[model samples]
Target: MTYTHILTRPVRFFGFAALAALLAAIIFAGAAFGTTVFAAPIERTDVLIGFKNIPGFAEHTLVRAHGGAVTKSFHLVPAVAASLPSAAIRALERNPLVSVVEIDGEFTAIGHSVELDNTWGVAHVGAGSVHHDSVVGTGIKVAIIDTGIDYTHSDLGANYAGGHDFVNGDNDPMDDNGHGTHVAGTAAALLNGAGVVGAAPEARLYGLKVLNASGSGSFSDVIAALQWAVDNGVSVTNNSYGSSRDPGTLVQAAFDNSAAAGVLHIAAAGNEGNCPGNRNTVGYPARYASVVAVAATDKNDKRPCFSSTGPDVELSAPGVSITSTYLGGSYATGSGTSMASPHVAGVAALVMAAGEQSASAVRQILRDTAKPLGDSNHYGHGLIQAVAAVAAVGDSSPPPDDSEPEPEPEPAPEEPTDEPDTTTAVVSDISYSTSGGRTNDRHLTVAITISNGDGAPIGGATVSIDLHRNGSRIASGTGTTNSSGVVSFTLKNAQTGCYSTTVTDVVAEGAQWDGFTPSNEFCK
Candidate 1:
């Protein structure tokens, strides 16, 4: 669809239009004649066609001269269309004056993301099961680092606490370009009836505009925006843009800083698929080990053609024909990992909302809960499944100390010798490796084994174990060690910093327990 009378520009009156036209014709003819063709190899002519302000055209039509719109540059989009494959794209490049020919990609009109009302739950259409304890991502702030945002849009205004515009170094994130606005909307549009629903309706959104109106930005600008996201209260960031350049220190360092700060950074896997020329060159921060690279998929969970795919991509999300908020209080549909990145960001908010999940926790949950999408390379872990992800954060902490070290046992001579001591002491070795962890924090793992002397099997003995860390007990549990004397328990979010833990036997009194105390450390 075409927008009408979108923008108006003042015109200057010119009396000698005919004379100027005649002089322009003379120069045009001279340049056209000077252009030559080579029959031996390939013939090409670079002609910069300028469409003088045809009245009634919007400002969008007036392409900036600096970006492939100069008066004497070849029109790449039409050139590619006109030149036959047999002629080769290089034919257009044959001309010394011709630079790169950028095919003007077409964009689709988007539906209002407001069709579905808010259930006050963080869920997507196909998001698996609903978590009984709805994760309220309200307080967690997520930064949408992209073009810019229509922060004033009705559906997006409420969640938009505040943001910065690195492109112009301003606070207002007005989208002179529409790309960033849509991305921000997908990540956290207010659950209002005006426009569209976002993945995380309760999340606070920070708009970091790094690209100009043309949906492009310099590497420096993007890096600066990333730094801004980390410096602010943003715990998660979504970057939909990508570049063809190889990985650079500026981008890598930014990602590393965000990771070090325990912030989740999501980036697009670029638009170039498994193409020959650009195959291994995955997008910047996505390829960076620190960032979670997202790929695009359709509703049916199939990888989209335009989506960039590689081992770098961690997961895929619905990106094709995804509807979201646009500039000027409008809605638009876009298809790219750009759209997918926000989905993961919203999911991250949901996971974080469940509890104080670290960045690594959220990443692992997404990876573990993903629906395997055939090939691992294209979909990474698999399609992002929100419900399963939330559920994976079980009410209890994960099992601890898969590695059960042998416990040093003191002789349980108190038991009957010939009876074979049905009741025997059981123990496992445990230890903590870190020190000076987060202040007032605790982290440790325990290992326990149940058995009689001579490595004889001991069964039916209900042994209760408790962990006392930093002079305060953090974990306690009772279970029977089957066949092989082994039991494990976990304690999470106890306290910050290093703490020495001691194991206690609640059953069989004296001579019933045997194990080493392990140290666990916790930090922010």
Candidate 2:
């Protein structure tokens, strides 16, 4: 069962009514301010503007005065979505009623996965244990700002709360494509026992249709969704979508407003994989300080090749081969950081349901309890741990004071030694020793041996190791077991310091065997 996502390929939308009113502004904005629109056929320049404590009518008139027209108005967020000629942006910004203006950009939905077999993601993060305590994200409204949700699906309908459709301008936010439905399932699919279970199965779900059928949407629609999440007292908003470029000032401000309103906006770190430059390529709104950027990891706590890494990433989750709810009341699997983000969102809902309603507090709890992997840019603080987050839940009045001691790391799952048939698949022994101590000649050897109950060596087993120095992985390697079931990985040019190694055993037919990360400090 694979989970995680990215739905690339944005389709152009050109409904006659939405087009005719905005073409002039598109041309004007494009020509005047160096803004470019990838809009096909009808090039309309759309933008979201936050008003500066001004009357609604005055803000409306201001847009018209600059050759623009009001297409939509938000409920509580002092903002209006409109299309204006390029020349009008400066004037609108100059108006006392307008506080910020930004070009509406495009966005793509996403997914990430390692296997499509068993949906172990929910259990991997310890949601299984939290569920037994009856803290299943009940009453917490989590808005999935993706394509849309298939409320008709039996597992999701009861928890489905009505939402706005920023795409075609109607109340029905049903998902035309399957991306949003998948995201919804990951975050809050019903615990019906028949299909896959979600992280927060009982959490109220709202489908904010920002991305279109082609899995792409504009920045204005996203802002509208964000505004709705803020106005409605939504506990959390899961944004499993992103764009390469930063969204304009209006959207950024909207994110800030959402955070202030206690709406935890969780977003994908993007699937660009450091792009062509191997850079820190986290995208907006994940890159924004107000949003919790999420990175993707497989069940073994390994970062996928496509998961983007950067300073903006706040946490990681199981994204590879993650299986969850899908269109037509079915389940499907896919891969991308898009899938990883919703896991955190679901965990946030769980934290909120546990009585911590403050967004900052929830974020801090998540960070404090997360299982640290290594390297902030790659894995952030490490994979999100659901059990620890729920366990660390405290008063919602304010975040735990910095002076307070941080929570301890959650323990890994116990490795099963014998099968039902009494056949033992021993996880032999993982011994870490260092050799070659000279500067620039330091070497670290990680030996992993596997055997059966008969004490016979099991060959063909895969041993993947992560060498950690000061609790951070500084080097890693992969090796295969020999005929005697022993695999050794020697790190060349190893750092001259005490280091620990995490080894995993993939017993060919046993990819599920996530070797224990038994740490032993050995000096070079």
> Can you tell me which runs of candidate 1 are displaced by over 4 Å?
1-133, 274-281, 397-524
| Candidate number with greatest lDDT | 2
lDDT of 1 at 192: 60
Per-structure clash totals for the candidates: 21, 34
Q: All candidates' TM-scores?
A: 0.52, 0.65
Q: lDDT at 308 for candidate 2?
A: 89
- Scored by lDDT, model 2 comes in at 0.72
Predicted candidate 1 versus true structure: per-residue lDDT over 245-265, tens digit per residue: 553443455578668778889
Q: Pairing residues by index, what is the TM-score of model 1?
A: 0.52
Q: Candidate 2 has what TM-score?
A: 0.65
CA error at residue 51 for candidate 1, angstroms: 47
